[model samples]
Target: MTTDLVAAVDIGGTKIAGALVDGTGDLLHRVQLPTPAGESADRVMAALTEVLGGLTRHASWSRVAAVGIGSAGPVDARTGTVSPVNIPGWRDFPLVEGVRATTGELPVTLVGDGAAIAAGEHWRGAARGRSDVLCMVVSTGVGGGLITDGRLRPGPTGNAGHIGHISVDFNGDLCPCGGRGCVERIASGTNIARYALAAGWRPADPEGDTTAAGVAVAARDGHPLALEAFDRSARALAAGIAATATLIEIETVVIGGGVSQSGEVLFAPLRRALREYATLPFVRDLEVVPAQLGTDAGLVGAAAACWSDPGTFLAVGAAGN
Candidate 1:
């Protein structure tokens, strides 16, 4: 029997990854390349084209039924375009069209990276079996999505449950997104490291270990400044999660990404702070947990997006669950 597959692509600021994924959420064959994000739009597309070319040359390409792409976004599924915040060259770039052109008539599905993570978690990861969920990626930046009524609701612009940019403070520092006291401004990995450094939390091995992971290690060792930084970031995340729950009544908040790798350092304080902020009756019972898919969430979620009716060039969505 021939195994059916979906070609999945995950495009982010740092990397571009693609895989041939089966129905049961397994990545069969994969390839990765650093993204030329700082290059011209054509140059970036050229790199993406090279990725698809690799997939097409694979022996299993014959069984591929569809193509799914999850890109760092402020994507417009309505128009089959993307304007990812980190990739400056691709403002309203016709990503769907470009992919379609690459893979011929194969149906392509496009969704924001946040929405992609949501679909992945809801379909098979931490938020599995939950009808309502908020899946967040808290790495160099914070991105999130919503799953409601047993379905991924990526919304019109494919950036619906973007809790990262939600204002948690009115008189706070300015975020690059032109917002004040946004969740990303406080809780992202970059901000976590930034806060620790600003507060004189130097790492024991100061060569290149001053990142959030280093902070986590220091926090575990009882460093006051490092612990304080994680706590502050957790507080901001708690506020954002509580706000989202208050607005739409999500059942679970699934946290993933680089910063989330801190395990207890991030989750322990986040749970404590969530209890303090989620005061309302309905929002109080919200469960916060780790993501099961780890780094594969984006690729798996991209494949899942193919099942959604996000109105790409071709309407066939496989949702290979």
Candidate 2:
């Protein structure tokens, strides 16, 4: 069988999604399972295995030449180990080895979710034309990766460009990652809802919706507390983006994931906050925009990150190796 596609896995705090992606960056088959993030490491691996099994059963599996995993990190690419902060059970998890065992020993490439998103966006999405860019996913946990000098630099340990973990407040709440006032502690979807609820905000549909999405609805309805929650998240996000821009000179930032879906409720304040933080002349022109790839950024980027030839990313159609 002609191997023209890859098995792509996108691992986040909330979900473990998989896809059979062809060279054209199209997902021929997709599957997903909620991450048992709070469960034991074995349980999390089971969820990941199920998602991967779904793809292996697809007819296109024969065309899958490799496996690409884009996971939440602090990942050690050198040793194929991962220590994701949000998933407490996984400390130094041998993800690549485990994946290889599940995929019939196919070649596996591991990269941080942020790096994978950056790879996908730089390949075919929002950051396509930019040499210096930051692609972020603002979901249950905030994460980011960088594109610098027209290359996807995931860093040696696959932990570079971790904007979400960057400290934004010196005397703020302690984060799950053992840091005080990290951007993810304030700007992630989980934190957004947590903060809003703590402020006595009521969700529009509190029965089954107390998430950031619920808060977004209330914010749109002009609820002060909901608005304040999103604004606070935006402020932290903006500060982190600005700090990254100031350090790396990245000109554009692509924000995606669930929180970014809140539309104007998030972007409006984010843009406004950017003005307050990104005041440096060189960083002033930094542009923050929504990701074009939407939810597929992670999967597509996983495919892109594993491409045998990096130039394959520029192909809009059937460009896999």
Candidate 3:
């Protein structure tokens, strides 16, 4: 029997990746290009076009039944528009229309990267077989998606599970999203490094590294300030996770991205802090695990968004809340 396929696009500030994905969530033909984030919107579109162009050249393209897009957001799935903060050139950009135009008007599904990640995990990764989950990526920025009752809930605006911007410290620091003490402000890799540096945690080597990975190494080596930074980030993340569980009763949270690669450094403190914050009986059993799909999650999930049963993609009525 011939395998069916979907064309998937994962778009972010730094890169545009496209793939032809099979029904089993496997990528067949993949292509990538750097995103000209600082350039004009047309330039970014051109890059996306190039990615789509490459995918269409593959022989498997003949089997592609639909096109799916997972974009750095805030995207309005309702209107097929996107406004990613990192990609300033795409404020309310017509991403769905653009992709449709690129692929001969094939049916296209657009979702936030976070939502896409959640769908990927639910379909084939750590959250597989689960009915309730929260999937997150904690790298340059923090992003998240939700699975409620086994369905991918994109909400009205396609940003339903945006745990990053949710305020954990209302009076703390101001977030770029105009919120104070957002989870992203305190828990992202960028914030982890910033906090460690500001707390007098200098890199081991003067000319070495100063990124979050550097801080993780320092923390493992017993740097007090570096350890403190990770602890703080873990605490903030725990609070956000607990809040989400409190609201919707998720069973597990799968974390991905560069910062999550810190492994025990991040998870140990996170589990400890979760014990303190997730005290409710119903939420106490929630599990926090590492994501299994890694970087391919966005693409796979984008394809899943197109291929999963229609009932699984139904929007939750109050998802926007």
Candidate 4:
């Protein structure tokens, strides 16, 4: 008997990853390629094709029942399109149509990367068993998704819980997304490093690495400026999380992405700041936890989307042609 499977695709700014996932969320086969982000839209599509083609060539491809995609925002599940910020070539690109054209007859499900993360966590990660939760990824940019009443809420455009663009401080700083003092402006890895650099925190590495990872090391070693940068980021994250919890009454906030890996340097101050912001009675029990799945969360979440609703976004008959 053939084992049931789903083709999961995770499209980010840096890479486009694909995998054949089993019902139990185990990846049976995987393929990945760099996302030609600076190239034309067609070039990006070619990269996606390469990844999907590799997955279809696997021995287990015959068992694949559907395809699911977790793409960078803002994705319009209703319109089967995507407009990722980092991938400038794709502005309302026909992603679902392109996937359907490539795979021929398999149904496709589309959701923003953040929504996908939330779905993955709700199914098997830190948000497991929780009905109301918020999942965030604080890397180059801050992205988030909401799970309300035990259901993933991707919103009409698949960009529902976009906490990154939500302004935590109306007058703090102008965000590229045309918002003032957005959470991402303060808490994202890029911003963290930028703030540290501006505050006189120099990297100790001979190569002069200024990434958030470098700053994390400096913070660990008790660098005052680096620690202060993280503290500022944590405070911003706390404000954003608190606002989300207060508005939606979420019980948990699961954070992933590179910056979240800083552990105590970020979470310790985040918890303290959360206390100052989330003062509502309904939000007092909120908890913040690290994401259980690592980089594989997006892939697993994409597969979970297929397993949950095979034809939610694309027609089932559009695959395998």
C-alpha lDDT score of every prediction, in listed order: 0.88, 0.87, 0.89, 0.87
Best by TM-score: 3
Best by lDDT: 3
- Write model 3 residue lDDT over 1-321, tens digit each, in one string: 353788899999889999998878889999999999988888999999999999988877777777888999999887888898999899989887777767985677888999999989988999899999999999989999999988788776778899999999989988889989999999999999999999999997998679999999999998999999999999999999999999999989999999999999999999999999999999999999999999999999998877547423322221211
Model 1 sits at a Cα RMSD from the real structure of: 3.2
lDDT of 2 by residue, 51-123 (tens): 9889988988888887888888888777788888778899999888778767985777788889999989998
lDDT of 1 by residue, 189-291 (tens): 9999999999999989768589899999999999999999999999999999999999999989999999999999999999999999999999999999899
What TM-score does prediction 4 earn?
0.94
Residue 253, model 3: Cα distance from true site in angstroms? 0.5
Model 1 lDDT at residue 252: 93
lDDT of 2: 0.87
Worst 10 residues of 4 by lDDT: 312-321
Tens digit of per-residue lDDT, candidate 4, span 1-321? 564888999999999999998877788889999999999999999999999999888888888887888999888888889999999999989998899877887778888999888878877799888899999999989999988988777787778789999998998889999889999999999999999999988998768779998999999999999999999999999999999988888999999999999899898989999999999899887899999998999998887765534224332112222
Off by over 4 Å in 4: 1-3, 309-321
